[model samples]
Target: MQAAKKPVTFYLGEEVAMLKLQDLKAEAQSSWETLNLLDGTELTAEAFQVVMRKFGDLRHRSTWERICIQLEALWLLKGLENCDLIRTLAAPDTPIAQAYPAELLDAVLAHPSGLAQVKNGLQQLYSDPLTESDRICAMQFLKRISGYETIDLDLPEISLQAA
Candidate 1:
């Protein structure tokens, strides 16, 4: 039997408005600066070129369906199935990222490498002191990614205070 797709629910903060694509593009451009900084993918220069050629123009529209389709294509690319860069760009709670789709995010989390890459990328993005929008999106992304169970062990938190 065919499965039915559930409608996506967006969790927007009171102050966070869902801005239009032009605004999002401007926000992303100011925050990200370069596509290569999308360390989550670990995509080589050539692969990035391929992506640019394929989805570069189409992404301007930045609809949920379009993002999902692009992510599906990225999943097919050899050695890049776990690349969460594109999905990260669709971070939830931010109009800038278009709000990542749950189904696609689940598919990424299902794989071990995908989980790792996601964590790494999120950490890196969090570390960068970008725009306010970036910070909000990063936190939301972290919350969503942390819910999954992992074989990896938890490391002890480092504290500067006396033990």
Candidate 2:
């Protein structure tokens, strides 16, 4: 018999969203794989060039940083399951190199716009019917930009489980 599934919850203040962890994991993995395949899974030179060209505007720094942070978290969360595959796709020199300003990241994390963008982006990715890869990229993009310390670790154990 199949094992009982684990429940996943995302809580924001009084709001709570529920889902199956197993299903979410599967979707995340599929999305990562698709992204890797599309870009040759190597973060190749061409890929980096493309990324730099596309995200060259420093004016949108907040958006860029938020996306990166989300992506990093998603990578950490989902990549842990398939170490080898994740490693290959997440080479160090990717276009998502250290682009966010330290000061900006701090400000964004502390500001409402940063949090709202991340929350909205995640909600859209989770709810939309897009391929897992697009979702993974979207999350990765957010993670790369948002400040690391912004992730509240002081929350109860249950609160940390969903994200």
Candidate 3:
């Protein structure tokens, strides 16, 4: 495949971050290639830590949209192991936090503990702006993964009263 033609630029106020956007792109490419060749099912703690750190850093950057676009292009998850990305980024107030929250919810939904965790998180998003965003995401997850439906039943019966 051809390399991306446009270069990613950042608005730096002081000392630039250690990892460049291109570096993260390279990591994604490497991950894609690795997953295609000899994909492993388990996430090593070191690697996990590295990925988490990158994501944590990403959440705080002003270049979040660009970075997330690159990541989305690069992150073609191989299996449950790669679900870590989705899990970690599912919640929190960040540009990339809401990026692909629902994309791999199915992976966790398949696991009992993971599913419970997601359910609890959904419940906890009560009144914040992110709540509606996250709730929409959770609803979408249920809909796509299964033929499930989300209903808002304020009153027990279907009373078609005009507001």
Top of the candidates by lDDT:
1
Q: Which candidate would rank higher by TM-score, 1 or 2? A: 1
lDDT of 3 at 146: 54
Candidate 1 residues 31-110, lDDT tens each? 33233344454546465445545545645565433444334423422223222353343443334333445555665656
lDDT of 2 by residue, 59-123 (tens): 45443444454444444333433222222222222222222234323543454344444444454
**What is candidate 3's lDDT per residue for 6-121, written digit by digit as tens?**
43323212222334555555554455345534554454646645654665464454344343444442342323222233334333232222333343244345444554444444
Global lDDT of each candidate: 0.45, 0.39, 0.41
Pairs of colliding residues, candidate 1: 90-100
C-alpha-based local distance difference test score of model 3: 0.41
| Superposition error at 117 for model 2 (Å) | 1.9
Q: Is candidate 1 or candidate 3 better by lDDT?
A: 1
The lDDT, on a scale of 0 to 1, for candidate 1 is: 0.45
